[model samples]
Target: MPFDDFAHNPRTLLHIAGALRNRGVSPLELFRRVGVPPSALLDANGWVPRQLCFALSEEAGIVSGDRFLISKIGASFELVDFGPWGRTIAGARSVGEACAVAANNVELLHQGSALRFFTFARHAELRFEYHGRLGASPHQHLLGSMVFLRKIALLAKVPEAVSVRLSIPYSHGAECLEETCGPRLEFGCDYDSIVIDRSILDASIGDVGPNPIEVAETAEATGALLKRLLPYGRANLETVAAHLRVSARTVQRRLRDWGFSFEEILDDVRRTEATRHVISGENSAIEIAFLLGYSDPAHFTRAFRRWTGMPPRDYARAFRSNYS
Candidate 1:
């Protein structure tokens, strides 16, 4: 569980399932290979561990015999796949503007990775990078993203100006990439990027409009995300921000606008939930501590004292005696 805290939108897995179905592979196979329960995607906006997704991509390659399977998935990329994030991207006035939005908000759509849009001279690049711990096998994401990125350029009538750049070498599935992505797909490169002509950056995509979502709705959404992530994502400010897919400062500012602080909200949530568990008498103090995001039972004891003016054991014993 070294990297278990990293998570992504479950929509990605559903997208993979649809693509696998197209290739005559059973979607259930994804769960078997990754050993995660099918219920993981039950919530419409819940988060899934990012490593499970990466492992599924790798396994999907084996079961389907197409390492380029992810590229095939990206080939059909639609704005809807990104949910509200897609709607925001669709509102950008130009290709470059969209790229800028994508760079700033990649975490809203995907966590545990980075995306950047930059220009040098006559060419511009949208670069995607995974922290080195992921190793090279996960390059399918780079391939799939490049294919999808090319579509953005195509919207501007400049598909020819777009090419793929991946640090991975040409191998098993490179031929399939060459056929679909054209010869511009280069392997063993220095970066994973979507290269475009600088001037094409000015190509119009849509009319500029105000963002469709409001700050208050975002604050409520943050609280909802916190409720879901508290059990697995941890209750710390940084972890909550990561799950909200926004910066910690942004999370703090939003919570403040709602007249609440992150610590206040987290403490209240923990108290309500932990109080219920202690009263129910179903789980031990240590188990409740772990569920409350405490690494040590002592931490939970201190917190329980702060919440109820007694340690967890005393509170639980008192509750049981009243019922008995």
Candidate 2:
């Protein structure tokens, strides 16, 4: 995958840096070890490298000499730390509603993983599964998530009397697990999950004072605008901003903070659609060019060459001849 696809919100890294600083560990040194620049932490809307985020969390455990460093950080994490998504979660009426919001919109915070929520006879489970292996980082990811889930449950004001257990796929030394997360750790489990009392699911967290319908509408609109150029569309920053009732410059700066550019996203869309059109053999180069919004066939050819290292005709020929 392209590095851009691996991007995630920078707040994750910023929070980790704050945690490391509190422990007297230099986050700069950790970033250096992981090959990420120190300046990346400053961008409020910036996306930190996905690999580096995991590496930093893993390194924090090693450098701080705390086996549960990730859990500590996650436990301390506040809903507001998640920005708008956190507010959406905070406004949810019940634990299940909150988990649903987090599970559905997790990619808005980090594109690396998927979250699932389930309810059984006596337990409500929140599960985390990454899209791919992160080498030694799953330990951190799983442990951090264990604490993060517990924190969210607590935020729902679930009673202390409720029983909660954590099931993890890895065995992280039983003593350390118990010492850090209490006696409810179940190792060698089928997944990383948080199990809480099912009764807590309906426990009201109170009205959070925002209209859920309005919040959902706003989130959907922003998501649609950001993804407008994908698959097939011609949308630039100015056009998108106009649609969103915002200034083009404001859109540009916000996109910058999110680790994307109007041009780059448009290019990605074109590159993807162009490749598909070529491979499918459904459109001539000129037709594809016109469909892709190019005025000149020659200009489209040049762009296609830049995208694929070959002319469109050659690429199509190679693709069809192989399958035929």
Candidate 3:
């Protein structure tokens, strides 16, 4: 799948482009290989596939220790299509209803993840769990979720009583952290979560329609379709087409209509897995390269440099710097 289909915003691509440039790779070459128009990066509001995003990361050699290329990419951009959902959600009758709408419609924004919403007497909590390897970093999902929550509050025009709880320790410094999540932000938590005051649930959403249940159903259907199309470990055009009882040609044509090729999709899946391996620190660069099907360490190095600007060693060093 094209990364354009999975990304919430195009600016993430720009960040990757910049990182690639830093590593001595030509951004235009990377964009061409990934099938992204060079100009699309400037339009921050545009969307791309999450898989493409991961492929770009792999191409950039971002897989590994401390630099958090994914978080930087995600954080650098604002959510596209967020405004429409925000408008619809803000009109909801209560915080509960708004949370429900957000929970329902999130798949419209990104499908490789799952969300759970819980309503308690005192607070409403939203938890995001990613079902696949994210292109940038594991924590990218958490940061992206936080950004989504922040956008939701902005769209709802609610008082900013919402706060985020994160599993990673704060590395961006106290001031930057406070600015990002509000003074209420808490890090080094067991999991990532967003909490909203229960009183917000009582607020009336005058413009919301009465058919949230129907909308929720439609959202679910959309989510299912997105999940079917996304690149995953089990995904191969032939395998998918076989299961769907369609010819591989038909599958290729269908994905072509969406501007992606099967090779691109498989490359994305491999790239995402490669990043995960790098972050876990369980494999050498050469091993990871081979695991992803590269013929040798040199080819992996060349490919990694193309994907991320830094060499694998330097990328890993930067990534670990934040953790240390």
Candidate 4:
């Protein structure tokens, strides 16, 4: 198989960077070995040459010196890291629904693989098939992804997962991989795929699955809602949820999925607004505190201390002294 005609997401390399760090491998050294720039490691917004992504991943695997690096990548992969594609799948009510959602959004990843959902008389399969395999890196990359999909199935209590497919020939070392891939695994297959019992398709994701609000876009929306509610001093969970037209409990759950607490969002809003008003010199500390919904100036002082390591006035003075 050829390597450079297509494009691939750079996030795989970003994940590899984390894996390398975990194994005491310097990302800088890996980047040098792979001949990719450090800045490009984080350039996940667009696609790069297919060859480069695989090279980085393969090099990272070598540098980490960890045989279980693919499993490590899967273990650390979070819903948020997948961005909108991940959130949409996680938001599905059922396994089939999630698979359907994933099926629809496969192109967004451009990860040198295609996903197709199939229904048989006995079961349904969410297949991750590579377009072509140039080397070991492609299978390694796809295996990490399959493990994540399998994790979702396990989380949803799917009792039967058929196995994982690998493009390489079978070997003794591959047996140890079952711990990460679960009990079933196949080797030397044309593609990598996951199979689960058809009965589990209709099963609900319940509280165990990731929430859609975990996506950064949704997190920003939550932040926007908090900004508007802060002046009311009731920027607490219930009030913000009311503004969002979602139940308070849902708001809490979704924010937790977004990796933040309501209090953290509220504090961030207060700190940001406080800094702005203070820097603008448009209001007294008391007025700024009131505007930030603090009942007392002392509370704002304490918060500013926690945020900037200095009281508001002292920081304001320092800000001016430095800028003036």
Model 1 ranges with Cα > 4 A deviation: 206-324
Model 4 agreement with the true structure over 131-217: per-residue lDDT tens digits: 764544665666677887776666467545455766668776777778788777878877567777777888888654344323344
lDDT of 2 by residue, 1-324 (tens): 653456567555535655676677766567657765544433435576667677777888899887788877776566765667778788788877887788888877777677888888887777877776554465675677677766666655654523335454545464565544556666666777767777777777764443433222322344455444432434456666788787877666554433334565456556666888889888888888777777788988999898778998899888888888
Candidate number of the best lDDT = 1
For model 3, what is the alpha-carbon lDDT of residue 317? 78
Two-way lDDT contest, 2 vs 3, winner? 2
Candidate 3 Cα lDDT to native: 0.56
Model 3, span 1-324: residue lDDT tens = 433334655433434554454555565566667666443432334566666655655555443332444444444433332445555576677666777787887765555666678878788778776665565554544564575565444434565768788778877643455545566778788767777787676666454323322222222222233234443324455666666566778766544332334555455445445556777788998788766666677877776676667677877778889889
Quote model 1's TM-score. Answer: 0.61
Candidate that would win on TM-score: 1
Clashing pairs in 2: 45-257
Scored by lDDT, model 1 comes in at 0.70
Candidate 3: stretches off by over 4 Å: 1-51, 54-80, 133-136, 154-160, 172-175, 204-324
Model 2 stretches with alpha carbons more than 4 Å out: 1-4, 133-136, 159-173, 178-180, 206-324
Order by TM-score, highest first: 1, 4, 2, 3
